[model samples]
Target: GGSPALGTRLKYQRARWERKRSRTAKELLETEYKYLEQLDLVLTYFVTILKAKGTLKPAVLETIFGPLESLYSASHVLSLHLEKGNLGAGLENFCQSLDLYGHYAENLEHFFCSLKGISLFCCTQEQVRKNKSFRRFKKLQETRPQFQGRVLEDLLCLPLQRLHQENSLQLLRVQKLLKGQKTQVLTPGRWYIREGWLLVVPSKGEELKRRMFFLFSDILIAAKPCHPLHPLNSNKLSCQAVYPLQQCSVDKVFGHTWSQGGLLSVSLPTLMQVLFLSWHGVSCTHWSYRLLVTSLSSGKEAPLGL
Candidate 1:
């Protein structure tokens, strides 16, 4: 296409101009350092005004400028290495500089979400391209033809990947937290409750109904059985109990039952010993059930209560 041909011609012209501007990498690096000094003067002027007006809090100012200091230091070191013809050291410093920028990008997004973030964003968008530090980096890279294609592109874009990976890890932690906050172990069972017969029948009526209980890391929940008996039928399970385990201490747990009630009882540790039902006719034995609780609660470690 004509556009591709035009782009190639423009690129060649840009390369020629760049070569005329700086004969070698050292020259380019030196030029960048000089430009940075000019930038520092301008930045210092603005910072002084901001400080005089009391617009910049000490902590906020540190947060904003700490990364910039590191970035500048890295660039200066890289330039020194370049001047000394230390390519190895210069490349090492270059990668470190990129990593520092990645760290800065990660923090910058967080900063932008803060109180004065929007104004900063607008100011930077308006003035950042004109920034000497930015132009310096662009010029240095432009002069180096070896730093073309995927090699340089990926190195420059390392910050975006770092941001994405950090965000993904945060999201993963949130999901794990949400999952841990809820009940994990659920068992479908039955509970026998005595029911009195009608007065006309004149007989004691006893019935057993399907009951289910869920054991969470923090609380225990009693629920009614499902109609269709689907394992994942959440809608069918009606809430019957919600006992917070933190307040209650395990008192007695009975595994064997002789046609009579032999369920686990928990005594709430308070001014008065409040008794709460723990389990009756669970599928697992008392010790096995306790192990399950330990595994779920990670050895009685209470949930964060968040």
Candidate 2:
């Protein structure tokens, strides 16, 4: 072709911009990788030098920096993905590390924030390319499938939307719980308590193979899980509203005055259910019930109902 059309030129420009952005992000990630390497080396030498001079005990040094060891390993893994241009995987790892910030012995939220800021910058750059619109060309080219796919890939990797520490009440392994309509047979499962919902599934099964039961703060659902042996199109469990929690009654029974082991009974319009939780000490049970009650009460005004 003698010259490309306006749309074609726009597409080329967009692609070029994206490639440039990716390159910049890769450079930033590499810089971070090198910094971390140097930091580790410096830390090792400093510790070694101190120990040799008898200025610092090896145990004291370990006590101080042991937690950082995990952070270093996690960061190294992220850098490896970024260096390989695996942005999708890197982003997922970055998001998951958000949970680890709380676990750091020394506060490292600011460091993680810098990493997030850089990642966001790269994402914004790519987004600008995706949204590069030519107002003159009314019939602009459709969005590239690759860009759409990338968006979807990131979406799936993201944590549960609107889920925060305040909203994520508790996660417990329920030795057994009721499942399905007839309330047939007790089941051992996992219960994930969130601001306004619960995700329940068998504790021992693979994630995809197990069907999820959702109990929103306001409602209860009953449905058959997809058969683990012969799932249809990777069948997903659907929730049906049975009754509103607003009209339901909740009764908690404890083993002792300050009971740790207890049963939380929820009476709905059409059904009654009890969740039993016990730990080595009654304190564990007490906390679980307290958290459950708190989650339920707060869910009434929860910003995200689901």
TM-score of each model, paired residue for residue: 0.28, 0.29
Clash pairs, candidate 1, are none
Q: Residues 99-134, candidate 1, lDDT per residue (tens digit)?
A: 466566655664454433243433244344445554
> For this target, which candidate reaches the highest TM-score against the unseen true structure?
2
Candidate 2 per-residue C-alpha lDDT over 1-306 given as tens digits, one digit per residue, 9 for 90 to 100: 224564464455445534643664476486656546544542454434445655334544343233444555666776788788765456445444544434441222322224333432231334323433411111121133323323221221122221232123221111122222343112222223321222322235534221223343444434333222233311222333344555656555544333534444555566545342333344334334434553465444432221
Flag clash pairs in model 2.
260-282
Q: Give the Å shift of residue 231 in candidate 2.
A: 53
- What's the TM for model 1? 0.28
Q: Lowest lDDT 10-mer window, candidate 2?
A: 169-178
